[model samples]
Target: MISWLMLAQAIALGAIGAVVAIAGIMRRPFGDWVLGAAALTFLTLVVQVVASIIAPIAGAGPTGDLLEYWTYLITAVVIPPAAVLWALIDKKGEWSTLVVGIGILACAVMVYRMHQIWFVQVA
Candidate 1:
C-alpha cells in the first residue's frame, strides 16, 4: 500500500474512533451521527480494499506473508459493519456505541499491521 494512504487511513480511523468513544462516554444513544461516522469509516475501508487490489498491480506488492496481510485487510473491512449491526440490534445504547468505537480503533491497528506487511515486514 502507499505510505501516505496508509497514514491517512490511520488518522481517519483514529478520529472516527475518538468521536464514537466520546459519544459513548457521554452516555449518548446510538444515533444518526454514530451511524453516519460508522458508514464513512466502512467506506474508507472499502477504499482500502480497492487500493489493496490495485497497489500490487502497480508494483507495490507486499513483502510479508500475503495470507497475513489479506487477513488483516479483510478483518479491518468487516469490523465497522459488524459493529454497526450489533449496535442496531442491541438496545444497550452507549454500550453499543462503545463497541463500535473499539472496533474502529482495532481497525486502525489492523491497518498499521497491513502497512507493516506491505512495506516493513519480511516474508
Candidate 2:
C-alpha cells in the first residue's frame, strides 16, 4: 500500500460514513441519490483492490500476507453493496437508512483494520 493511497482510503471511508449518516439524519431512503453516493464511495474500495493487486505485480506489495490482505480487502468491498441490497428488500422506510448508516460505519472500521493489516509483517 502506498502512503497516499492509504490516506485516500481513510478519507473515502470518512466520506462514506458521513454520507450514510446524513442520509439517516435527513430521513432519506436508499433511493437514487443515496445509491449513487454508495456507488461512488464503493469506487474507493475498487481502486484499493486494484492497487493491491497491481502493487504486487509491480513489486510494491504490502509487507503482510497477501491472502490476509486480500481477504480483508474483499470483505471491505462487500459491506456497502450488501447493505444496499438489504435496504432494497427491507420495507421499513427510514429504518433501512439506519441500517445502511451503521453498515457504512462498520465498513469504516473494517477498512482501518485492512490498512493496519497491510503492515502486519513489518510489525
Candidate 3:
C-alpha cells in the first residue's frame, strides 16, 4: 500500500468515473473508456501488491498490519474486475452508469482507507 501510488490510482479512478458519468448523462457510450481505465487500474494494483510484498522483505518501513492491509488490497484488486463484469453483464445504459457510480464510491472509500493507513492511530 504505497501512499502515493494509492492516491494516484484513486484520483485516476475518480476522474474516469466522472467521465463515465458525464458520458452516461449525455446518452453516450463509455464502455471502451471504462474498460481501458479498469485495465490500467488492475495493472497498477498488481504492481502495487508485488511491490508491497517485496518492500518489507527488503527492509523497508513498517508495511502495516497484514490483515488490515490485505483487506484493503483485496478490495482494491476486486473492484475493477467486478465493475467490468457488471458492465459486460448489463447492456442497459442505466446499469452501466450504476456500475461506474459504484466504482467511484469504491475509489472514494479506498482513498479514505489509504489515508487511515498512512496517518490514523492504528491500535
Candidate 4:
C-alpha cells in the first residue's frame, strides 16, 4: 500500500466532492462536464482499489484487519457509481447534485480509511 499515492487519491476525490457540493449549493445542475469529471474520479478510484488489492496479494499490502480493509474497499468501490446512476435516472433530480457530492465524499472517506487499514497499524 502506497501511503502518499492513496493520500493523493483521497484528496483528489475530496476536492471533487467539494466542487460538486459547491456547484449544487449555488443552484447549479449536475451538468455534463461535472459528470465527466466525476466519471474520471471514479475511474481513478477503481485503479487505486485494484492496485491496493494486488499489493496485498503480492505480500506488500496492509497487515491490519482484513475484514475492515475489505469492507472499506467494497464500500469505496460501490458508492460513487451507484449514486450517480440513481441520480441520472430521476426525471427531476433536483437534489441529485448534492447527493452525488455526498456520495463522492463518502467514497473519499472510505478510501482514506482503507489506506489507514492497509498502512497504519493501530495500537
Predicted model with the maximum lDDT: 1
How do the predictions measure up, each by TM-score?
Answer: 0.94, 0.83, 0.77, 0.88
What is candidate 3's CA lDDT for residue 81? Answer: 84
Candidate 4 lDDT tens digits, 4-57: 878888898899888887777776777786677568678977788678778878
lDDT of 3 by residue, 1-123 (tens): 466776776787677667666766666654677678667767877877787688667765343466676678778888878887877887565667657656765765775575566445354
- Give Cα distance to truth, residue 30, candidate 2, Å: 2.6
Q: Candidate 2 on 3-83: residue-level lDDT in tens? A: 677777777767777777777888876667667656765787888888877877898767767677788788878988987
Q: What is the lDDT of residue 106 in candidate 2?
A: 72
Task: Compare candidates 1 and 4 on lDDT and give the better one.
Answer: 1
**Cα lDDT listed for each candidate:** 0.87, 0.74, 0.68, 0.78
Alpha-carbon runs more than 4 Å astray in model 1:
none
Can you write out model 1's per-residue Cα lDDT over 1-123, one digit (the tens) per residue?
888988999998998898898878777888888888888888888988898899889988889988999999998888999999999998565498888888888888899889988888877
Candidate 4: misplaced stretches above 4 Å? none
Task: Give the clashing pairs for model 4.
Answer: none
| Candidate 2 TM-score versus the reference | 0.83
The best-first sequence of candidates by lDDT reads 1, 4, 2, 3
Q: Which candidate is the best by TM-score?
A: 1
